[model samples]
Target: MQRFDGRVALVTAAAQGIGAAVARRIAAEGGSVIVTDLQEDKVAELAAELGDRALAVRVDVTSRADLDAAVAAGVERFGRLDLLVNNAGACVVTAMPEDTTAEEWHRQLDLTLVSAAQSIQAALPHLLKTRGNVVTISSVNGLAAFGNLEYSAAKAGQLAMTQNFAARFGSSGVRFNVVAPGTIRTPNWDNQPDALDRLAKLYPLGRVGEPEDIAAAVAFLGSDDAAWITGHTLPVEGGVLTGPSALDLTPKGPFRKEQ
Candidate 1:
């Protein structure tokens, strides 16, 4: 709908899946997008697919230098950054508390939490100049307990960072918010059969969410329509946190009939 016309957006992990979907939506709405990811080839390919509206940059979110380079590239190409989507994140699919070594914990934290912080830090000055906004792709697990402890912890940290940035930059005209998706159907879910089933059951919608579902919320939050929305953790979880039905009197059942 051209909601982002004349704007510039920088989206991390934009090579595929949710990040790619977000980038595509922003571009479709007339926003110039910088697609960043560690997968250089994939990002380049997608950028090409998006044509001149997008620029591809290789960035390892955990590396300050990489993030700096990415921001610099965006400013160089687009002249200014109007929005930042911290969509880069990874999960630990096979580790429990006892099994999660320090290295593993740091790996998860660095990719999910610290990476976004670094990107924000690098892009803050440009964002300040433009009075831009930041949208972080956190998870529902950030607010409540979930199976992946390390991932949840990292996402919680991201949510906290979003609030801190929003409060700190509010006066400077920079807005920050978090979008917490429940169980989105992305490539990350490809081999996670157990996780898929569990999440599908937990969601009252009786199905997994789509990347566009999350992206649509992000697009709104990043637009002028959401100018008043900042420092909020918006859950796009399809009623997962609303608890089970009381009338059923059973621990589990199809919450609603499928349409």
Candidate 2:
């Protein structure tokens, strides 16, 4: 359980939801983490909650300066960096796809894909020394057709980026991987309670994912437990990738149990 003992990690967008869950999981496993997010006060609260093992820094992942400072602060506080969890992405496109402006597209990519790449660049030098790894939070939308076109594209970009980084730095003992999750009950879905309920029916597991669900996968990929793993996308979805009809159960699934 203490797989992260003596390790230090940097987690972006750690104020809430999946990000906070991942940070907590690492800290629970005896790792130190630098938690960053645009919500300064929220991150500060999270840092306080995690006590000495965590540090809170305000980071607008879209801002390279903030990203760099966050990385530096972690290294300064913890000595060395081992893992970078890129979880600072969102679905910002509100307009129709055809009507979406180039500026909006830029903003979307900059927030999701570019931020992840930038964080990697900032953490690479330190990761090299520790022979550490990165675990990016992508989405199933990247693997299949989802309504958020821009977000899906950015998520897909993460997969390719991880693979290339893994290949380029594999010899140096650096690893890169991604966790693609299905619908998770985050604060974003707080207002859409019915949406979550409806989405759950589509999942073979009978429920949408939780932030902790994704967090567990991140822990595995970031720790030495996955020393031989690299450049892979582990879908942390609850069997949704198999399609709801792909299974049989008393409920949640369409297929019935054999008599």
Candidate 3:
């Protein structure tokens, strides 16, 4: 739609998956994008593919210095920043509460929650200058208990962080929001057999999501179309949260079977 013509966006973890999709979408819409990831080669390849519309930077999102450098490089290249997509995150560990160690929990929070906050901190000055907005990649895990305790908690915290920032920065014309995705076919599930098929049963849409699904929603929120939208968590989960209940659909209808 060329909604982003002449704008510049910085997207974290842009080497692949949803992050890469976001970078492609933004660039396709005529935005100059700064794509950051720890995988230098892949990030560079993406930037190359995007041609002059993109710049690649290797960044460890947990490191404040790295984030500052990436932001500086983006501003230096683009002249100003119009959007920040905090897509760098991981579900480092997945275990039952009792099986999850304190260290693992901290690691998850550090990767998913703390790093997003830090990225916002690094980009706030530029955002304030341009009256830009932030669109963070959260998950359906955050809104409901879908297992992965640590990841869920961290994702939930991202939503809260976005809301708080939106409230505080609205006066400055800076907006913050989140896109909570359901089971998307990403590299993380490459090891699993038929994972997308199995996950699709839980969603009313009869299929799991693609990276482009989430990217489309992020594009909408990041565009001028969403100028009046902020502090909202948009669920791009293939109707997972609103799907019919299995128990209710059962022959017994939420009751025990005949003994």
Ten contiguous residues with the weakest lDDT in model 2? 244-253
By TM-score: ranked, best first: 2, 3, 1
What are the runs in model 1 whose C-alpha is more than 4 Å off?
Answer: 192-198, 244-259
Overlapping backbone residue pairs in candidate 3 total 0
lDDT of each: 0.90, 0.92, 0.93
Candidate 1: worst-modelled 10 consecutive residues by lDDT: 244-253
Worst 10 residues of 3 by lDDT: 244-253
- Residue pairs clashing, model 3: none
lDDT of 1 by residue, 104-173 (tens): 9888999999999999999998999999999999998899987799999999999888998888889888
Please give, for residues 79-100, the per-residue lDDT of candidate 3 as tens digits.
9999999998888766778898
Provide TM-scores for the models. Answer: 0.91, 0.94, 0.93
After superposition, candidate 2 runs with Cα above 4 Å error: 246-259
Please rank every candidate by lDDT, starting with the best: 3, 2, 1
**Native-vs-model 3 lDDT?**
0.93
- Ranked by TM-score, the better of candidates 1 and 2 is 2
Question: On residues 138-170, what C-alpha lDDT tens digit does candidate 2 reach at each position?
Answer: 999999886888888899999999999999999
* Alpha-carbon shift of residue 132 in model 3 (angstroms): 0.3
